[model samples]
Target chain A: MTTPTPRANSGPSGTSDAPAVPAVPGPLAALPDADPAARERLHARLVDGAERAGLLDVAYRTLETPVGPLLLAATEEGLVRIAYGVQDHDAVLADLAERVSPRVLRGPARLEQTVRQLDEYFAGRRTRFELPLDLRLSTGFRREVITRLPDIGYGRTESYARMAAAAGSPRAVRAVGTACATNPLPLVLPCHRVVRSDGSAGGYAGGAEAKRTLLTLEAA
Target chain B: MALRPFEEIVTEYGPMVLRVCRAVVGPHDAEDAWSETFLAALRAYPELPEDARIEAWLVTIAHRKAIDVVRADSRRPLAVAEVPEPAVGGSGTGGPGAPAASANGQAQQPPWERDEELWDALKALPRRQRAAVAYHYLAGLPYREIAAVTGVSTDAARRAASDGITSLRRSLPGRTEQRTDAGARQRRAHQREERGERP
Candidate 1:
């Protein structure tokens, strides 16, 4: 594939002998021996630079999932990312990288196994995601809300107010609405299973249609 | 129920916008800036034309916030220079007047410097060009998104990035030189690690 022209501002010209990086527009691969701190610092510069330029829509990636593809988006700040795949791959990925964090990489290798397990679940062979996810995206409240969800057992659902009360914000039905709205990682956390107090679908970041489809699949 | 403009925008553009904020400001500031940027967008949504690029518009707002932070940081007071005693209150014995002070009596300490030539080179770019480079190269905005945000045609955004690159090339040091120096440093660090390992 033809490489995109190197940005004239590319980091210092190393020996021309070094293999030129190809412009394959997949998830960013790991940098060799990457210092996590340096990577974070450099990513911050990029995010800051982009912010200074006033470009906000975050960029994200779609990992193939059993129910469907999963979207994972993050900001350059920390890993408190969001996931909402099952539609519009290009737009979602672009938004994630641009707005969330340009330092996006493929999800941990274990996610692939998780994806497989999810596929098996859809195939009626497995039931839960056992892979390690970098759930650094959720806040304490959101995390508490979501963490309570997977324990919600497959084929079951909970009400928003109940989730709020369960998360120790018993007076926060509105707050529950917000927590669901801002659920960084959606399906993995199964925010879709959270419904309105009236037992109707309240809202979902991935569109109500997708949410319904997911709920239906789980119910099946 | 129809998605509110705020929800729609957040669903559509939240991650990328947050990324940009996270990049420039820290993670802490990113959420506030993100909330503000969209809140502003929501208020202005009705005014947007159908042809208007919403993502571009959102990004431009985020950039403004980043610039505001930068400008605010610039306003902090400089540390007072500890100038040597003005000998006027001193005995005539030529006591060490501390290090020599400038004619204005400020201490001659090395100008508190960032020595950030690379950052300086980036800063030297024209505003739009610089923005284009930062967004495209660093923030990794595609040309189309960059175009959408800058209110420029896509081709124009591409050119801005290209031109910004050209300008930065002229201003910044060569990449090859950096690679060489980095290689040397890596080698030294490796050698030191090896020496420690040998024991």
Candidate 2:
């Protein structure tokens, strides 16, 4: 640790018996006690005010589930991205910053309705989500595939080839598979509903095990 | 590497920036300065370089925000010069010298609630010296980066920090001893860690 170097070169020469100056604490270490809860409340208010004033372009929060932590993010449009823990939450936020906007904050209050609905879904009370979604992260065929997913209905599964045909590209089975693998919004958009043509569950963005968990939950 | 979430950045650096703000502008204006600094940083975070030193970046933003606060203060109507005596009991409302209540009815604690002597010593330093000490000692910025932020030469930055520390030592003799004792305790703890002993 670099002790603050004393003023050895400058200042009037002192006699040898002068008391030594104590080391200054680091800037952060020197602060008076702050109420963390108050600060958090203050930040939430700031973010909300900023968002309302059109200064904040993105807001995000994490939600806990039986599976693990899920990163939920939104744009001015609506809920945009959802990533499982395995997707690396930090990387997902960086992607949102690059793709959506850098003005992102952890304003959980903005996601209150979304989280409440999600909690209801997880608790097996809600059968559908009525939240607004921003699908700008997906484009072209992928967007079409994601758009078609909700139509597969809750508790129903679809084969990739059949889903590809439903997406207006019957021969684009591989493309549909690619779409599911890279869906920016997973559980909320229901990418786990797509399986292999043989009825074996295919890959999922949240990893194969998470996909299994979601499927089993829906089947029950 | 990609930039982490702005939320993570806030969690990691908020306290440090808050401390810097309070030290530079006093507790009265610290919260506003902090909020402005972060709001500005968030607006530009996407374009920040991948490997940029986040602490330095935040300090630079904080320096600019603190200047803005100072400018705004200069434009405000002057308050009476009398300093309030410290309060005797625990009170949320700031004592006589407390900051005016915020718009939301939040009563910010007065400087006396903390180390008044140290805060007074800090506030008495010349602006350059105060900034230098806060950036170097508080924020841990090197003289080179401090120079960049303060627009002073590196040598000047170092001199200002040194001068500031000297002034503080003179003003708060009792507190200086406490800091020294704390430093010694920390050193002992580090030594214990090196020896694989529990601190």
Q: Which candidate has the top score in lDDT?
A: 2
Mark the 10 consecutive residues where model 1 chain B has the least summed lDDT.
Answer: B86-95
Q: After superposing candidate 2, which stretches have Cα over 4 Å from the reference?
A: A1-42, B74-112, B174-199
Q: Give the chain B TM-score achieved by candidate 1.
A: 0.44
lDDT of 2 by residue, B120-158 (tens): 777788999888877766666666678889998877887
Query: Which one wins on TM-score?
Result: 2
Clashing pairs in model 2, backbone N/Cα/C closer than 3 A = A27-B138
Q: Chain B TM per candidate, please?
A: 0.44, 0.74
Q: What does candidate 2's lDDT look like per residue over A90-109, in tens digits? A: 88888887777767787776
